[model samples]
Target: MTQHSDVVVIGGGQSGLAAGYHLRRLGIEHVILDAQAAPGGAWQHTWDSLQLFSPAAYSSLPGRFMPAQEGEVYPDAAHVVSYLADYEKRYELPVQRGAWVSAVHRDGPYLRVETSSGDWRARAVVSATGTWTRPFLPAVPGRRDFTGRQLHTVQYRSPAEFTGQRVIVVGGGNSGAQIAADLTGTAELTWVTQRLPRYLADDIDGRALFDAATARRRALDVGRTDTGGVASLGDIVAVPPVRAARDAGLLCAKPMFTRLTATGVEWADGARAEADVVIWCTGFRPALAPFAALRLRGARGHIATDGTRAVDEPRLHLLGYGDWTGPASATLIGIGRPARDAARQIRDLLG
Candidate 1:
């Protein structure tokens, strides 16, 4: 039987749960479809050593704050997963796990949501599918010929398996830096970035970046086009682990390689760096596969939204797709505000 909901959220991660919290507060009837068999969303699949950039208080969803794990200041991935599960239970949010969404399309007065297990015809659809599933791998010269193990940050786990091997980490982002640190004692590691890596001061953490981004967005909201030298997410934060790595002279990043060789990599001047493993810490594109049939994407392959609502398709709201959808919706702290706005818009639409 085809299920029906007033609204459908197409992910059960932090974004979806935040949206669910707001929807529940409004007494809106909705359902969340998750591809994962259990709760936690993409965090469940992240590398085991991953830790939030800030304390537990900073990494929270709407309505409920993420509790710090016992004796731990900053929560890890497992702690986050546990919190998500508890959040669902606390609110009794209707979530259908293992229901991987295949596609979504127009269906007369409502939108039809197709999934692996069943279908849902919803009055509104909030796409909270984040970028974790679709890891972006940049094209390096002679990429196909490299015979060694090459993996993206998405597939990264503990660095213990890489012990005694030569590993090269790519990208200058926080993920790249953290992973580089984790592989420090285990692997003979080399960090590579397109440009010189920018490390923020030790006091500047994820919250600072969020604040800077928020300020920039606020400035953009008004007529002012100038963003008075705000920091970007691409810059690395000086977390304890990263700082330790730097102290040990391990955080140095080399320039991007000129090309890949069968055994390793070659620099522009013909210098070679032999590596047994290559971990690409490049970023990600939004997971918008289900919205393909909607034809709502802008020139950038993302759904153009006006404060979370799709510009072309009003019934479709995209959440947790970074600043393009809403200010800071992609981060745990940033997601709550936009989720409330998106929920309000969806509730008003349903009414």
Candidate 2:
């Protein structure tokens, strides 16, 4: 027998939890389903030492504030997971953990979510799976033949694991840079990326980024008729990890690899660099394959939602999508409005 709900939220991360909380506040009956056995989603799987670039004040969910000191750099992965668990319990959000959603289809008027455990039907669906579902590891030729161990940054937990190993950290993103810096003291480290990464200043924290993006979005909202997508202004030229690496004389900006060999990685310029380990911090793809019929607009498999609301399917909403304007869109702080808006929209539809 298929269980039923007025609305079913897929993915029990910050977005899903916020959605459930708002729905409950509006007297809507809903259930949140998450594939993970616990609540924090990808955060739980993050490296143990990982910390948010933003501060704790900007990391709170809708109802509850993050239990941390003001102006403190955001908590690590473990603290984030603990906070999510606390949020779930405090709000009494109806979350079914370890329920991996296999597929989502529109069955007549309701949305059918088929999971490993069972199936559920709902009047509406919110895809809060976030953008980091699948790690993107480039398949360079001879990668399989690499003599040293190769791992994606997703599986990487600490530099201690790669101690005394000559490690090549690919991709110049924040994660890659940080991992390289962390390994510098313990191992021989080299940083690589296709383009010189444009680093945003440390002052460009999550709140500031959200605020600037929000103002630009509101201008467009008022019929200003700006050409092209909202251009990200402000100083995004100082990647923290890159700056740290430069300060430590450990930064190396280079083009991506042409192939991987048993001995080492070969650059597109036909130069070969040897290493005992390769850490690919390429990036992540969205978890939208299950909802393939939605026809999203973003490159790299991200669902292109319009300011918290999904574009193609207005009834189907997405929260916590990366790169949204406002202090509350991508961060835990920004998720509240989107979740509340989605809840209101669902309540109206159900009524």
Candidate 3:
């Protein structure tokens, strides 16, 4: 039997939960579909030492603020998991765990969501599935031929596992810097980047980044001069650990290698370094496979959207992916506005 809902939220992560909170407040009936068997979403799958770029007060869902982790200026992954779990229980949100959605297609006036457990027909569908599942690795030559173990951020747990082994960390972004910093003293570490790593000011964090993004968006909305945002500052934030690593001269990064070798990697200048492992902190793509039948993706490989609503199909709202969905929507603090707006639009549509 096909289940039914007024709205179907794919992904019960921070974005989806925020959407649910607003929808419930507006008296809109909806269900959140989570691929994970438990709460915390992607946070649960992150490295053991992963910490939010912001403090606890700065990272929170819609109705509830994340509690501060005692003795920690920046909370760890476990604290976040506990907070998300508690938030879910506090609101009693209608989330169906382990409901991995396989596909979503049009079925008359409703969007048919086919999942591992069952199917649901909803008047509107919200795609909040963030990008952790689709870790991207650049097409560097000889990658497959390399004998060293290669793993993306998703597979990494801790540096202890590779202690004393020659390891290379790739990419210039936060993940790359953080992970490379985490590997200090634990591995024979070599950090490589396509370009020199850019670090944000030590005082700036996700809070400042979110505020900048909001300012930029607001400025653009009023047709004023465009203001720069997080990108304007730099890529990586000088979080405590990252800053410490840099001060200690452990976070130095080399230019990207020309190709992977059977034994390790080689640079264009013929410099070679043997390695036992390579960690790709390259980032991710949107997990939009469920919407493949919609044919909404543009030539840029992203779905064109008019303020969260898909331009090709207004019935579908894409959230939490990135700025394309909403400014800073991928972050916990930034998701609320878009989630509230998406919920309101959904309510108006249902009416």
* Residue 158 CA displacement from its true place in model 1, Å: 0.6
- Residue 124 of model 2 has an lDDT of 87
* Candidate 3 stretches greater than 4 Å from native: none
Residue 163 shift from truth in candidate 1, angstroms: 0.8
Residue 129, candidate 2: Cα error in Å is: 1.2
Q: Which residue pairs in model 2 clash with each other? A: 199-236, 199-237, 199-238, 199-239, 200-236, 200-238, 328-333, 328-334, 328-335, 329-334
Could you tell me how far off, in angstroms, the CA of residue 109 lies in candidate 3 after the best superposition? Answer: 0.9
| Poorest stretch of ten by lDDT in candidate 2 | 228-237
* TM-score, cand. 1 vs. native: 0.97
Per-residue alpha-carbon lDDT of model 1 for 1-351, expressed as tens digits? Answer: 788999999999999999999999999999999888899998999998888877888888877888888877667899999988999999898888899899998999999999888889999999999999899988889789899999999999998899999999999888999999999989999999989988887776667767877887888888677464234544787778888998889888999998999989999899999999999999999999899899887776887888899999999998998888776778899899889999999888988
Best to worst by TM-score, what's the order?
Answer: 3, 1, 2
Candidate 3 RMSD to the correct structure: 0.9
- Model 2, residue 338: C-alpha shift (Å): 1.5
- Residue-level lDDT of model 3, residues 1-351, one tens digit each, is 899999999999888889889998999899999999899999999988788999999999888989999989889999988988898889989999999999999999999999999999999999999999999989999999999799999999999899899999999999999899999999999999989999998999999999989888888889998888788989999889899999999988999999999999999999999999999999999999999998887865789988999998889998998888899999999999999999888888888
Which parts of model 1 have CA positions greater than 4 angstroms off?
228-234
Measured by TM-score, how close is model 2 to the native structure? 0.87
Instruction: Indicate the residue-level lDDT of 9 in model 3.
Output: 96
- After TM-score superposition, the amount by which residue 340's alpha carbon in candidate 1 deviates from its true location, in angstroms, is 0.5
Q: Each model's TM-score, in the order given?
A: 0.97, 0.87, 0.98
